[model samples]
Target: MDIQTLRLFTHLAKGLHFGRTSRACNISPSALTRTIQRLEAELGEQLFFRDNRSVSLTQAGEYFRAYAEDVLQRREQLQLQFASNRELKGSVSLYCSVTAAYSVLPDIFQRFRRGYPQVHLKLQTGDAAAALPRLQNRETDIVIAALPEKLPGRIIFLELTETPLVFIAPTDYPGTVCHSTNSEQEIDWLQTPFIMPDTGLSRRRVDQWFAEKKITPHIYAEVAGNEAIIAMVSLGCGIGVVPLLVLDKSPVRKQIKILACSPPLVPFSIAVCTIDKKIRSPQVQAFWNIATSIENAYKKGPTPHMKNGVSKN
Candidate 1:
């Protein structure tokens, strides 16, 4: 089928609403329906089941959509492949959560630039949850996140940095702190100020872990990014708990300290993810390879459980 039909179909599959998909495709609802019909005729199979207010992919549609997407991917790659032949000069865009943005990604991008000086790079940061859909839409070449809740048939995941999530405070201003991912004494840190991240699974994990322990510290602030949290803590606004990776050496040694943790903290795995290999461009693959190789980028220290999630400099 035509690329336009496949493009329209891809958006339809995601929106799953005729009016919504039609609006997105910039075509009338009837025309969208006709395109789907034409695609079905060409393939001898229907692609969707529509029953006003609800839409689901037929088994045939599901299978064809997979192939259709591959076709679309190849069509895009063709141009990139040609460009690579000429010279691998184009932007490789990545979407990252703020944690990765501050922690591992800066170093990764630096090294990437050192090696691939001719290649341009673009990066945007947000909660991983917010960034994965952009990956699905092909808005970014790859993404660094905590991994999505579920992997759709169309994407791929590469384990990157598994860094320990830790409780930290300004180097000089500690009241009392405990170290345990499983559980900690609330009384120890009750009066200390807590900084909550605005969003992310790790934020949820920290929140739940505290709630279960029946400990509610006085929150210094609720901030949008890990960088801001660290900055606040470094300024001694209050003690803020953060992923250890977010604290680089100059900042960590001079500004923040790892408060004594009895149980140590739970760790979270960070990974590089993108559309499946068949769809990912070479530049994406090259960057992904380099990232995995630089495993020591953001470690807080060394430990068996922390290897994948925690980075120690």
Candidate 2:
């Protein structure tokens, strides 16, 4: 199979959804189906189990996924090796939440492009929680993510910035689910309808905060992305806990108000994460170096501070 075909297959295998894969790959659904069918026919094996509701990788598909990823990665390496005498001319896949793309990526992208204009950057924005998993699965070369409490040994994290985790509620909600209480005892933690993260570093921090207070949170909804939680909270559905960075970048910032928690939730340590093996790639290394320079500049300069859900230098 060709590099482009293998890339499409690997992306489909990771997401396991036809519509999403087709949209992300910029291909018609019917065309994508035909491509997969051709691959299966060429291999003489069923790669994916497809039905009306869901799609899943078959046994053969799982095996081929590894092979496909290896081939794609090697192709990138070979391209970089040949272009060493000239300019860097390869693609780097990046995954991050939309908020990160807006807040964190602009400067880095500007600088990287100035240095290596030939390097193509493929960015996929989605739930922040999925960043590490996508990186580990080799669906992307690098990801912007929060530093997990227990970092995997195979992953390398370079700190970019930190933001406090804060509780937020709708400003014009009809009910009294939230109040401006200075003490934790004054707030009704057990009765409040909390919108929590489905999984990720923020979820773990929120759970730990609740456990420390010895209060079982009344979870009203479990959302996948922090942006979704913000949207839900804006609709007067329930209060949510999210990073200050996300809150700052949200379009509905005026609709939501940050609530006071006596002992505030732990701040998130945002970073650029990549697998150990991928770090050796020239394109990946170039991106990593730019991120590292930004991190060092932040350390040496006056860091921005958050106030009233806004960042000020």
Candidate 3:
């Protein structure tokens, strides 16, 4: 089958939505249907089983998908092998949090664009926690997110910046425990309503902190994103924990105060994550090079006067 058809099939396999795949591939639904039909005719098997509500790969489809992926990879390698060094072209699918999209992506994109003008960059922003799973599933080419303490296998991490995880509470909060001047006084953490993330590396870290301190948190609310937790904290809902980087960029920065924990929380190591095999594609490698090349810039922190989504000093 043609490479374009294989590409469409791969997208379809991941999304399991025909309309989405068609739109993403920039093709008419009817045309996509025809292409799949042609492939099925050649292979003598249906690639997908679809009904009104859902779409799924057939057993044959799953097998075909593996073959298609291999063929596509080989095709890319062949193209890269023959193509002139001056030009690089292909799409790079990137996943990152909304925070990362605004904060870190602009600089990465600027460098990437200059290096590979012909490459198509597709960036999708969501929960920072979900980035790794999407990368593992091959749904995205790369992810920009906070790295876990124990690294996962078969992935490469390019460290970007380290930011402390800070505890925050509303400035007007009436909780005397956080405001106490007596360091010897014990705070009743069980009575203090706490806001935290439902999942993600931040949540894991917060849980670890509580465990190490031998305190069971009175979890007032388990929220989704750090931005949401910050908002809740700003509204006097409860105390929350989040990366200092996020707090610096938070719109409600003036609403909250950073609380002093007896022992400081560990800083988060933010990085660009990608699977080892996918980077073999020249387009992915091109972006990877750009991201790594700017490591020093990120380590030095955002420049003064709002340069490239990072805040000024």
Which candidate number would show the highest TM-score if scored against the true structure?
Answer: 3
lDDT per residue as tens, model 1, 55-153: 999999889879888898887689676866765666688888666776667777878888788788887776555666666655567887665345555
- Among the numbered candidates, top lDDT falls to 2
Q: For each candidate, how many residue pairs have backbone atoms clashing (under 3 Å)? A: 17, 0, 0
- Please write out the lDDT profile of model 3 over residues 1-313, one tens digit for every residue: 7888899999889778878777657899999999999999999999899989999999999999999989998987787896556577778999998888888888889888887888999988878788887776567888987877666677887777878999888886655234224444555677678898999888888889899988898889899888899999988888889999888888999988887786888888787888887778888888877776674444635642211222111
Worst 10 residues of 3 by lDDT: 304-313
Which candidate, 1 or 2, would have the higher TM-score against the true structure?
2
What TM-scores do the predictions have?
A: 0.60, 0.75, 0.78
Local error of candidate 1 at 171, Å? 4.8
lDDT of 2 by residue, 1-313 (tens): 7887998898899888888778767899999999999999999999999899999999999999999988887886787678787878779999999998988888889889998899999999999998987776667888988877677657877777778889899988947384326754366766678998999888888889888989898899899999999999999988989999899889999999998776988788888788877787888889888876753322222764211111111
What's model 1's lDDT at 252? 47
lDDT, each prediction: 0.68, 0.82, 0.81
How many backbone clashes are present in model 1? 17
